[model samples]
Target: MTSDSVLARKPSGQSDGFEHHLSPTAAQALRSNPLSAKATSVLSASYADSDIRDALGLLDKRGIQNTAETRRQLRLAVQKEVIDSNGDIIREFGHVAEQLKRIGLTIASLSQGCEEMKKHISAAHQETAPVLQEASDLMKQKDQVEAKQQLLKAFNAHFIMSEEDIATLTSTAEPVDDTFFAVLARAKKIHNDCEILLGTENQQLGLEIMEQISKSLNRAFQKLYRWIQREFKSLNLENPQISSSIRRALRVLAERPSLFQNCLDFFAEAREHILSDAFYTALTGTSVGGEEDASVKPIELVAHDPLRYVGDMLAWIHSATVSEREALEVLFISEGDEIAKGIQAGRDSEPWNVDGGNDFDGLKALNELVDRDVTGVARVLRQRIGQVIQSHEETIMAYKIANLLNFYRITFSKLLGEDSVLLESLTTLEESALNQFTTLMRDHVAGLQGESQLAPPDLAPPDFLQEGFKQLTAIMKTYETSLTSADSREADFEPILTEAFDPFMEGCENIAKHLEAPARTIFSINCLLAAKNILAPFDFTSTRLSKIQDTVDKHTSTLVEYQYSFFRANSGLQPLLQALAPLSDTKEDLLSIRSLDAFRPEVLIQASQTLDDFLPLALMDAMENLKNLQSSKMARKITEEAADRFCGDFERVEEKLVASDDIWEQEADEETLASSQPLKSLFPRTSGEITVLLS
Candidate 1:
């Protein structure tokens, strides 16, 4: 190769000739010259003559090997060895189309099976739908029916009454026993159940049930009452055992208090019936079974023995009523409890529902029974009292009146504290009895005062006044026991004091005035002293006794002074004046026995002896009278006053006698002395007598 061809060629390491060859145009374009010797040389080296001829034979524009040039090329001898690759690919595509047709047929079969299954599921749902819906509805109804049945069973077990129990209770032939109580217990339980179960849900049903229960109990109780009345109609209520058994039964029955109240009401009615009969019997003056004929009388004749029938009636009534009342106490029929029940019932709008404490109906019945018995007995007593006072006005003894007053006082004192119409009646009776006693005393006093003027003062005190004083003292003694008791207040004594003092003291004054003044003084003083002794034992704080004492004292001091003045004038001077009067009356001083005294010598001696003995004897008699007096204080005063007056008067008289003797002695002459000899001789004996008397 020429250098130009060698230079135009790509570098030797650029590409392998088979995997990467340049196109002829690219090769030709990369070649620099067409006629260059380097190109010619490269062509000759790559293609031998045989290779050139074969490459010219292989060339065709459409790769076909024949032409005019193809004939030529054919003649040139083309090599013939051929392989068919497109025929095998066409066979494989035919097999794949057959497999695709088989898969499409399998999918069509699956879609047809799915449609059949869906139609079967729809048919099954249609067949089961009604059954399931009916089952759900039945279950709901079954639950409701079972719940209702259970409710009915519970109500019957707790609240319903048995036929046998009801029949036994309703049957009047059956005796009251535990069965009755069992019935009541069941009834109460049912009532409580109703409250718990139906209190708010069904109030009207609860009320109806309670009403039915109440009626049933009432019917049972009525039957029991009838049975009791028939069986025990003649039972002795006074018998302790029977009464106790009955009371015990009542208390047991009272456990069911609502039902028991009806029974108690029945008992009260029975008691009232018996009480009415008894009261009627007593009113008609009819004796009971065992009482004597003489033991009772009509009320008008009660004064004959007022305490007999009246006292018996009172005692019997008290015993009967008190026994019944005690039984009621066991049944809770107290006044306090009943009053509280009334208050509670009034406060609550639903009064029937409250406990109310006690049975108001039973209490009312009991109260009526008590009031009837008490009122009936009190009426009889008052009537008897009135009759006695009216019938025995003139004949009743003072002591009997006193005893009647005392009886009334004691009997009514127990009742005075009670606040009832019965107590009011008792109070009226008491006041009436007191008035009767007062009237009797007033009448007696008037009679005494009227008769006082007829009594002669020359005698002792009038008989009426004496008897009155005696009566007063006896009354004081009788009433002392009453006065000390708490029931007899100070006011009770006022009437007695008023009655006694005024008339008796007036009588005393009249007796005193009728006497001579000196004797009157002593007599009045003694009478007053005797009165003081009689009155000293009593309390007369507001009475006329004090006034009597004042009158007595007043007369006493006057008497003392009067006696003193009399003694002062007459004590030693009277006889001396008589002795001097005869001597002064004679022509000459006679000085004889007749002239010496008021009479002969023997009379003078008697007169002088009498005068000498009088003072001591009088003083001794006064002291003896003082010794007999009950009060030494009064006696002492009398003794002191009388003695002082007598002593002073005698002393003054003695002084006058002595001064007269001195006058006679100083005036005497010879003839006068001869005349005075007899007088002077008499003077020493007279003076001696006076001295001896004084001693």
Candidate 2:
């Protein structure tokens, strides 16, 4: 066969043997025959190219034939090589089979063990199911018990208080401190919370706790009350600063209204006695401790001077009142809000203690207490001042004392309320002084009225009236600087005006009654003008000034009328004016000049000569009549007005004369009229000429 056929065909049984002994990679290669065709082509190309002949020639030259036997031998050698490779592969397969058998046995043993473990696990599960269920039930019970324990702990903490807290709140051995306040607050809260419990279905526990807390709160309040009372007893109001403990105690005790008021009452009574004694010591310069400082003279030293004595006493009282109020101010104002809240809370809890819906007012309480404290001082002051007023003979001094009392009355009205006893005492004393002054003035006036000659010789203001006005001016000065409001000053000073000024004016009027009409008018004018001068500077005297002006105007009118009458009579027109008076208002011009002898032309010419003579001296003569009047300006004004009025009368007279003359002309013949002068020449002085002459 050719090398190609030999290469393409496998050795008959060798192929089966090689396939059986092949390693996996080698067996795969043989089954696929990846190089079979290439090997065949390579063999065919080698043979065609004489490569076999060349190989045989080389073999023959080596003394070897390239025959079929040699080829058979080469095939046998290849088969042997194949057999060796097969042997090695068979050994490797044997070793692999051995390893795989050992692995299979190990896997079978593992499977049997796994089956045994599965059966054991199922048996264990069946056995422990009841125990696991028991443990779960136990855990659930433990959680529930723990939750209930926590709830019980919370209940015990909230609803119950310890004995220590109670002791701190109610026991006297423990001092009032933060702990005590905290305990008291807790107790109060517990007491209030009992109302919540009472709203529940079970009311017994609520009632028990409520009663217990109520009793505890009452004891605690009583303790605070007594402590406050003790503190007040030792309080030194002379020192402006107070202790914090006392302030806190008072704030707390305000919750019990009855106790609070009682404490205040007690405090007021004690302060009243103390302040009364202190006032006496200050006045007398003799204190229980010892004599007062020599530099600070006693008020009694000035007793002879009633005004100073009263003023000093009032000053002392005022100083004491201010100090007392300042010392106690912190007690009320510092904790005002807290005290108010406490009182309102107390009002809710203890309704029976409330009084007519009147809430606690710190300022009002302070005023009432101060008023009570000054009660004794006010009484003694009133008595002493009343004595000074009664014994004093000087009317002006009495009036001054009244003014001093009035000033103090206003001062005390601001410190203590207007309705306070101290203010009322001052008011009464002021009224007493004023009454004494009024009585003295009235008596002085009555004595003046008894005088045989009341008016001055020159019709000037009398000495008594001048002296009264001097005193009144001093009083007006005092009232001007007073604390009275501007709106009320007029009203407040009215009584003083009536007392001080009116009596003197009335005395002047009464004295004027004895003089003649002219002197009487002058005297009245002098007195009214003097009073007006004194009162004009004060705003409060406007009403009185208006009245004085009216009276002066009335008297001035009288003077004008008197001057006008003088002009008429002096100018020789009185007779003619009398004649014309019956026909002055008549509209008819039928008057007969011959029937009225004064209206005759000769009579008219004679009157015109008198008028021309009087017109030159009219104002001078009128002013001479009023020379005794106090005010020259007033005299001049009256004179000028009278002269103007006389001019009007002259015009009327001139008109009447012209009319009468015309009527005569109408009745008489032309020859009879030629015998008489013209009416214009008859009345030579015209109203214009008279007006110019007067001016």
Candidate 3:
């Protein structure tokens, strides 16, 4: 083949023989389309060189004014038949030439004015050019500043932590870097130097320094101690006795005053006391009471129970929050592009400050402040988390106490129908206890979730911020959109919930169908009630209103351009709906992000985050709502029958409940009977009237 017709192939098996490949002409065409070139060149022809008169001129002297006017003015006017009487007619005709000359001068002035307009256009464009340039420059500088700030923030977050502390902790902990170690050394030196300060009259600063050091230790020592403790504590030690080996470890700890060393000994001994359950809790707690056996007062706690319906609520909330964040990101993407587009966030000043103490420049500063809506989000989250924890704790306590009393009612059945009648009294007491417990749990969860009439209009979020503040205000609006499919779903027994499950609303009917009949009825009622009360007004106490208003106010402040109203009206609706779905059909919580399969992974993340605060409370509120539904007349009647039936079978199941080893017999054993001159203290049990069961 001729060289001109030769074909080529790459080493990796790429062949180049297709006519579809770009030729020189085609490549040139691909560089830019015809439309692009046409646009720029469209008006360029009008931008050619200007006429001479537009350049420069002497307006006063360099003019013929008007040729017709000059010629007319040079000539004299004559009138026929004006031969007598002082030539008055001749003088009138001559004045006409002078007026013509003035008209010619006016024409010249108009030409000059046109030329001046051209010069003005050029100057205007010239002035605007620099202003545009300066704006572009300022934006560029701001972008550079933003990049640097991001890098610094990233460094602090990821790098400074892990590299330095690697000597003690695992790889998963913070990546402490050289800077951290350097800082650590500095902290040590500062502490040593403070000793000298204390010796002098600088004791105030010295004391302050000491306090700061103590705080640092509190923060840092926890990690240090934990690592050492893990290392020193043996895994195989089955013995709890403080043997010689244990004493040696203790002795070494006492001699070595380092926090790490001390921790090693403490945890080593502690492992003996810590059961496998405790160890499990320490690692990943999913149970109540956790590692700390005793209750932490003024600090109610709730364990993370993966099995509870609330877990699903948490998962959903996590996903919804994540989605919200991402949507927000999309909303701000064009705006945030200012940074990547060469605009920087920096302090604006005619001259730099001594060390540039200020955060960001005018536009950049505003963007940074506004863009940190995440921080605001985080703050909201923290508050919500704290509130949710308290609410859950309160609810758990109320339920647990109720459950405990319920235990007593069933346990003391042997004496329930006896002559002593103590069991009856206990059961009555339990009924009151349960009633109170339900009330307390409901109230506490409501308060934590801010369900009750949130008060104080002043406390309410302004306009848009009320996004999450109110209970019903924040809860999901039923997707009455489901009504369109209700007829299709009515006859079929399927999950009605699946339609709401996916973002596109799929399989909801089928899922809803799977819910228990009671749950369905309760949910349907609530939904109907919710629909009827959609626009109802509430009058709440000022304090309650204020808190509810606060939740609302948070989201109100979030700026949503263009479709702001649409978003505000519908923001967080899906999450609320998901939470309420359980109340709707008693379907389990589709809580975590995994359930929202219709959305992209990133959107799921954002959704998860937004719901983070509200999910737990939403679940609690829903349960309470269900409880209320169950306590209705019909439901109560059903429950009473259930309880009666259970009591009727009490004798048949009596053997299953009694504690082994005759708890009564132990109290009345030989030791007691031998010493007894009929010992009254041990004989509290008059008979086998109320030998109770235990869990």
Candidate 4:
């Protein structure tokens, strides 16, 4: 305690001498005649006069003394105790409020189903429903609105976009980071909104909506373009992620970007209103030729593959049909402007300039929307033409696609961007596209050729998948390196190879389905000759294994010295010697040459029978030719030695076989004969006579 406490108190601790007494709170209270501001003055200035000048002075002194501790914790203050209790309540209650908000939000989501939702929202209204329900409704609205809005926002977020953007681009632009769905959602909504808001006919409204959507989309895309310009630094590029993402995102948007078009289609569901042949039927005499309802109504087109109408549509495309063309035209173009324009220009001049002669001016109106108008549209249509060239269905769809593409390329020169350095580059494509299309048609005809429904003979599944995998890998490696093609003449396929295969695949539906063994192997051999029939750039048929062997043998003919040097003068035969070194024992061949039926590459043709027949006269001619070789004196000497060895080996084999004709029938091995004989009896001639005759 301060000296003041001991002097003023009744000597609380220093008793007797000081005559002071005070506890800590009392001491603190007595320490100052006026306490700290928050502690409050211990002695109130209430002398019943309502003001004591002396007391006021003391309070002023106390305030001046404690000015430095303005925010100190007044642990001993009566009001501090009460304030602390209320702060805890406020903190706890705020936490509880946040928890309740989360719970209310969750309950609202669960309430989207009408009856269940109605109860959830209302059941608690008597207690807390009004406030919670209001909050829940706002949250629901926010959820519904945000995703759609985000989609719209993201649509324009990318650096590249659909062919639609290209159709209208004033400057070069590409879609980059935009989300596919946002553009779609907005496009559909804007289309629907335009149709509802405008008084134009359905087709006209669709056109206007498309134009507006295209324009608005271009604007939205400006945001994305800017974003991309900021973010993307390259193209076709080292930046694989950006380039690939751009292509994929644009492709998705391209797949029928007119989302509301489906709705428009739905609204115009009546037979009279529909324009597609798929939606209408025609009758020629007693036969019905077009798509018709088996009933009087429109055919029920399930969202599923439209299976019921596909066959009819197929027949339609197969035939020349206008309705099918219309559908494709709609799909391929924003409005088929160039096609219509070309057709009109062609038609108006009496020569009929392009397309089908301008019956579709409606496309022109849409063409006006973009600054570039039809460039992107024309390019997209043109690009699909090459793909159409590969399509199995050369139906009207393919034809329309091809024709429109031709018109675009032939007229616009560079509809598909700078795809080539010279305009003639695409002109070059004219022959290729036509050829591809023709080949596709030919294949299709092959597939549909016999309609022979006979079940194919069951092939025994090859027993070894492991070996098959190896062979498959090998085939892919060789084929992957070079494309098969249109060269005029290298070699012809062996006639025997393919003769066995064509019949195998006559019942097979598609050639692609037959690439595995037993088909791959059987087909490879059988189709060997048929390769000449395949449409490749190659002028000659495929070379066969035997043919390759024949060629190799022919080329190596000058190696006579080398061949015999293998016997004695082996220096120049190092390459061959090296190659054959791994095959050490020529006599221990694993193959059997007993007959042509048992022949193999590793077999030593050790018999007069093989020498007499399948040994190929060419081989003997080679041996004879080697005997007369003038290239090397050493080679000539080596050949004489080899001939002697070859002849002697033959005689030795003949003598042994005769000697043991019945011996081999008993065991896999024969004991070495103590007394060996030459082919003296078989030859019936003396060695002196043979050597003399040779010399």
Query: In model 3, which regions exceed 4 Å deviation?
Result: 1-121, 144-148, 155-257, 260-695
- Model 3 scores a C-alpha lDDT of 0.36
Model 4 per-residue lDDT tens digits across residues 142-212: 99899999876763443224566443332334344443335545554664555553565566745655686
* lDDT, model 4: 0.37
Better of 2 and 4 by TM-score: 2
Query: Cα deviation in Å at residue 345, candidate 1?
Result: 8.5
Superposition TM-score, candidate 4 onto the true structure? 0.18
Query: Which portions of model 2 miss their true places by more than 4 Å?
Result: 1-149, 201-203, 206-212, 238-240, 289-296, 302-304, 354-356, 582-591, 656-670, 679-683
| Candidate 3 all-Cα RMSD | 47.7
> Number of the top candidate by lDDT?
2
Better of 3 and 4 by TM-score: 4
Q: What lDDT tens digits, residue by residue, belong to model 2 across residues 1-695?
A: 34444435554444323344647886566546758535433433434348775754555565544468876787687689889999999999999999999999999999999999999999999999999999999999999999999987975566567888778878888888878778888888888888898999858988987888888888888878877788888988876667888888777787877788788888989999899888888888777577676655678985667788988899999998988888778776676578777777778777675372877787887888889988988898888889999999788888888888888888889888888999999999988998898899788878866876568788999998998899899989888878788899998889888878888888888889888977889889999999999999999999989999999999989988888898889988788788877775342543554467776778878988888788778788878888889899998988889888988988997787677667667777888778866666767777788889888
Q: Which ten residues in a row have the lowest lDDT in candidate 3?
A: 497-506
TM-score of 3: 0.13
RMSD of each: 25.2, 13.3, 47.7, 31.4
Query: Which segments of candidate 1 are over 4 A away from where they belong?
Result: 1-154, 168-174, 202-208, 214-235, 243-371, 395-409, 412-432, 452-459, 477-484, 487-489, 510-524, 533-551, 563-636, 642-695
State the C-alpha lDDT per candidate.
0.56, 0.81, 0.36, 0.37
Question: If both were scored by lDDT, which would come out higher, candidate 2 or candidate 4?
Answer: 2
